[model samples]
Target: MPDVKFKHVVSCSSEDPKNPAANLVAQEAFRKWKGVAGQPSVSVILQLEKSTKVRALDIGNEFSAFIEVLVGKSTDTEDAYH
Candidate 1:
């Protein structure tokens, strides 16, 4: 099996651009999600216009996340039999 790839996108904002607490808040939030296994290509989107509260949007629906997993070999498996 090929190495699987995953993408995690998080959206958050800061009340004050100069406030040092903002970084801590975001960092903690990211840490929580990072603990999950098989998670690669993590990304974060910051919206300075919005409040400090973190908001997440599920890629598919209310019960699901936007994370995508792709697994497959780069080479052709069909030739294995030959």
Candidate 2:
């Protein structure tokens, strides 16, 4: 199966500038997105070139136990993600 590449990072709940959320979508995919230390949970909103249904995902875990993925459309308003 082909990989789903993201168009860009829409909004990130919390991220360490050193390792930005955008790195997760980078073509290289060498870098990882890191949240600021002490945060309980981090959320990220990403845009795709078109609508896509993800059947599988390949991830390299570091210190995380579980991951959640959310899918939605983007509106013109700031609260586009729903």
Model 2, range 1-82, lDDT digits (tens) per residue?
Answer: 8878788987899999888998978889475888898777877887988888888877565577777765667645665443
lDDT of 1 by residue, 1-82 (tens): 3222222222422223343323423533332223223443343342232223324433322223565432232243632321
By lDDT, who's the top model here? 2
Clashes of each: 0, 0
User: CA lDDT of each candidate?
Assistant: 0.32, 0.78
What C-alpha lDDT, on a 0 to 100 scale, does residue 31 get in candidate 1? Answer: 24
TM-score of each: 0.19, 0.75
lDDT of 2: 0.78
Model 1 TM-score on a 0 to 1 scale: 0.19
* Candidate 1 positional error at 34, Å: 2.9
